[model samples]
Target: MFTQDSKRALTAAALILATLTCGCAFESSPRGELGADQDLLKTCDPAAPPASFVQIDGTGSSNSDAIAAERMTAVEAIARRTAVCSGYLRVTVFSSSSAATAVLFDGALKMDGATENARLKRVPEAVSDVMNKVRSAYAPAVQALPQSGSDITAQLRLAAEWKQQLGGNYCLDLTVFSDGFQNIGVDLGARALSRQEAERLAEQPAVPKLAGASVVVAGLGRVAEGAPPSAVVEGLVSYYTKLCQRTEASSCTAVSDYATATR
Candidate 1:
């Protein structure tokens, strides 16, 4: 019933409306609720992460053997040793239980401190399962994982970022598995944190590692020592890399004893 001109005008108006509606995501996505400021509208930023102490209730893993995760602690200890507050670094090896979804650090574990985050990606389970046998072993000191893929990554990646940013009061409970290490490696770390980044973190005028970091480390400690040859220790230390910085001295540890003896 409308004239041709009116019809065109209506179509144009509709198109403009659509554009405006989509504009919230103009920078990217208009998914999140409308906000007064751009920071509030950011959809990429991870949500608040939990930060409570978690102790691993690993079944088959023993405490004597020098696990690769133990050596990872030594790697992160560099900043602390140099009198820089790089926070606590916790690591767990899904070495055995390939499907084990161990607990990483949360924000609360940061214990009232400034935090930042960068989740590298593919940290095993999308949502860590607290109901696992391991968690059951370490009861009364834990928080269940969020019921979303993003929440899981955001929770952990932010914690890692929190470590990089604040230094003190930070923790990184990495569930480094054999296959999972294919992406991240010593080279990736070198690329991510060059000498410049190291100096920046080391030179920062702030707190020491432990004072602010009432950190708690957790893991299933499940790297099957079942000896066919290499599978057991491979969980703790991933030797799977193509263009990696290979060397016996590299902090990308293989086993605790070998690394210790070499050191």
Candidate 2:
């Protein structure tokens, strides 16, 4: 034990043993604290990310500076939320004809893999880019308001179709920014529609099947110029609720303000 060579040999052996032990521990305990931190770094659910669709009513009644401002705020919130989860976002403008409906922005919110702190730092910048694009696309899309009529039902159908086409185990979220005025086929503004009537209308074949989807009809009965009476607003809410239910959606929320419609 007193020999210098023996001491050095023992030191080397100990070092090798330590190295092997550490390697074995790392291989066997891949789910340890450090590994868990790496796992937690991924903020988005890779298997079932949310697929969000926003439909803006580009009709005469819904066009206003105030409404546009509110929409921008709502869209920013939505874009931030979606970006945080690395989900999908689609913005569309709907008017009289579904055929004439325009998709302003359709893309995914993507983030790079990094440490939690790094991810947090990068999130805002990523979200800002997305919101900028959304705003740019939305402005021109809604500038020319349609005067023919509002085809709200057709918008729902289009969303359903888009969801089907985007096949995945995605959580569907549909947000419609509208005044809840249906003038295409069924006139929701003629008179206050009864719940029974709404039920019947929802049951029609024209209604899209949106099973397992979450639906939010924001700014319901909130027109730019003339606000509908309370009774009419109530009727609009009932109609949308029944419509969503008839489509077999998991949840339905029809609110007067876009801010209140957030999940």
Candidate 3:
């Protein structure tokens, strides 16, 4: 058996080969999957947080479902995207069925959070981890994405547009997942998705790029998908690294109607 050091060396060599050859051999996600294209993503300032209103309807449950089901939702799904120029982020949340989805109701972009500090408050470790990963993993890609470092300034224009809409101050609902118990003031209930739908959706086209940045599924809510939680989470992480344009402007709440899928 390979020692841990040897295994790590192999992994590093593989990462280098994959980067130079731009090969799909190292890791890849399916078509139509949630984060398949995230590798093409550019790094941004995590300290400032994402002002862009990018919504992440991950390959799993929606924020609305968590609150209505009184389920425990714990996830840190921050990502970096070229679309945002600066990194774009989306947080997954869970709460009692009676908890309000209103907190999740960010008008346009449909990417809202509970209270202003949700990202930093609930799971700061996960948040910090994702930001650092995005910065470290996507650094070369972000630098190489444009012809010159000066061109990066122009790219920021696109980022500015995305940010104007998603600036902080949105409310959100995070789900709980541990076996530990907690007291609730209100009684509530709801339903989760069938494994078939989740599985089928998993096969959908991923965003198209999964090798550029650090794609961590910090907090994944439990589901009937049935692979061990680690396997499922790892799979989702692979998937998240692949895709881009999670929800095009057409479905984007930011715009009134379809923007046409030119890509």
Candidate 4:
């Protein structure tokens, strides 16, 4: 009933309509667009991410299994929190000299997209990878007791330097896992210090400049051996509080456990 030229034009229009329908379907399907959404995370802003630094004391005191387990749990929690906002998290082991300190883990959380579907599908896998790396990096620290003395100040200084290097208005959250027994300099374990003495000691030039940073000193009184009396434990807390204040920290919390170290 139709002419040959008319039939040919009708066939061409059908083919074009089919192609457009396929394209539309592909765009609307989750499976088809997941790859493209993932690719977007690769270009996320690096400099503006909130920064978190954790310094674990690798000295003999913090080498026990219980402490290691607690540290791992705390680090996992921090990783999860950081991932929610696509922030940066760094873990390091303390050394007597800041220059000699070892970096355990350094990573930035990546998000596929702002949509809930993208977050649910991608964030869990990313967080799992981060925890795996953190566990791997932390293995060697608990294998054997470190020979080096604990230098809490040096680690703080190193963190301050890192924050400076970041060079932005990004907030820095510092968590220190230690027994608060400084043996390298200005011995904190020598005697129970009064609040005034602690403040005076923190005024020394050796203290790091941590202006605008929030600091949490966890496991402050849980030493490996010769556990100090209540007075000494109180002294340790006071010393760290004064020290954080001296460095101009935004907030300071010296607590005995990671569960209570939240800002």
Off-target runs (Cα >4 Å) in candidate 1 are: 1-138, 141-160, 167-228, 231-250, 256-263
Most lDDT-accurate candidate: 2
lDDT of 4 by residue, 1-263 (tens): 86653453344323211221101101122444344334433333344455778888877765677677667766765565456547678888775667646777887665666784667367668768877877787767544434567778877888898888876555677888888875476777788888788777766747787766677777776766555777877878888878777787776777554432121
lDDT ranking, best first:
2, 4, 3, 1
Residue 122 CA error for candidate 4 (Å)? Answer: 3.1
Estimate the TM-score of every prediction.
0.23, 0.77, 0.22, 0.74
Ranking by TM-score: 2, 4, 1, 3
Candidate 1 local lDDT, residue 4? 57
Model 3's number of clashes is: 48
The alpha-carbon RMSD values of the candidates against the true structure, listed in the order shown, are 24.5, 18.9, 18.9, 19.9
Candidate 2 per-residue lDDT over residues 1-263, each given as its tens digit: 34653453344323221221101101112565334324433434566676878888888787888778777766765665566556788988888877867787788776666655555456678767876877787767776646788888888899899899888777677888889885477777877777777667656636888877777777778787877887777778888778777788877777665552111
Q: lDDT by residue for model 1 over 87-114, one digit each (tens)?
A: 2333332212223335432222111224
Better of 3 and 4 by lDDT: 4
1-263, model 3: which lDDT tens digit per residue? Answer: 87653453354333322321111222334542223333222122333323222222222222234322222111122121212123334322222221211122122221234643332232334344554543343223322222111111112122333344555632111111211111122111122324443334334532322122221122232332322344344433332222112412111111101111111
Separately for all candidates shown, the number of backbone clashes (residues 3 or more apart, or on different chains) is 14, 0, 48, 0
- For TM-score, the strongest prediction is 2
Q: Answer with 2 or 3, whichever has the higher TM-score.
A: 2
Candidate 3 global TM-score: 0.22
Where does model 4 exceed 4 Å of error?
Answer: 1-49, 114-117, 141-146, 260-263
